[model samples]
Target: MKSDMSDTNNHGKEISDDAFATLIRNQFQLESLGERLQKIENETATMKDKWRRGDEAMRDFTVITITPTEFTLGTE
Candidate 1:
């Protein structure tokens, strides 16, 4: 059996079974790659949002000293 696609490659060329199968497989692979890329982008965005919220929460954080022992801590 042959697959007939009109107006392809500037001519109505009849595609053989093997060529048609390859074309279909390639299209499926491209679609799968696109889906994977979209998933990765979504995951990256979610990670960025989590990081932003974490940073904001840290910004409003406060530490209280329970014991009144003072030791000089210096950073060089």
Candidate 2:
């Protein structure tokens, strides 16, 4: 009877340790996701600004395409 009671106590302790480890792992995963989202947002904003500048510059550019051989560029 004493040996059986010790076995039960060991099993309970193992189960409790496993639960704690699982909880920590879940928290780490959540933090990683938050960091990735922030990076994506920053990159998106930078790209948007670059696109706007390129569009503005193109509007001020002049087309001077030469026939089949060469070309020149000027701002108008």
lDDT values for all models: 0.78, 0.66
- lDDT per residue for candidate 1 within 1-76, as digits (tens), equals 8778565662777888899889879989999999999999999999999999998777656234333354344743
Q: Give the TM-score (vs. native) of candidate 1.
A: 0.71
Q: Over 4 Å off in model 2, which ranges?
A: 1-15, 62-76
User: lDDT per residue, candidate 2, 1-76, as tens digits?
Assistant: 1122234435534445555566568879999999999999999999999999998777656333344345435633
Which ten-residue region of model 1 has the weakest summed lDDT?
Answer: 62-71
Error of 2 at 28 (Å): 0.6
Best by lDDT: 1
* Error in Å for residue 46 of model 2: 0.5
lDDT of model 1, residue 26: 94
Against the true structure, whose TM-score is highest? 1
TM-score of each: 0.71, 0.56
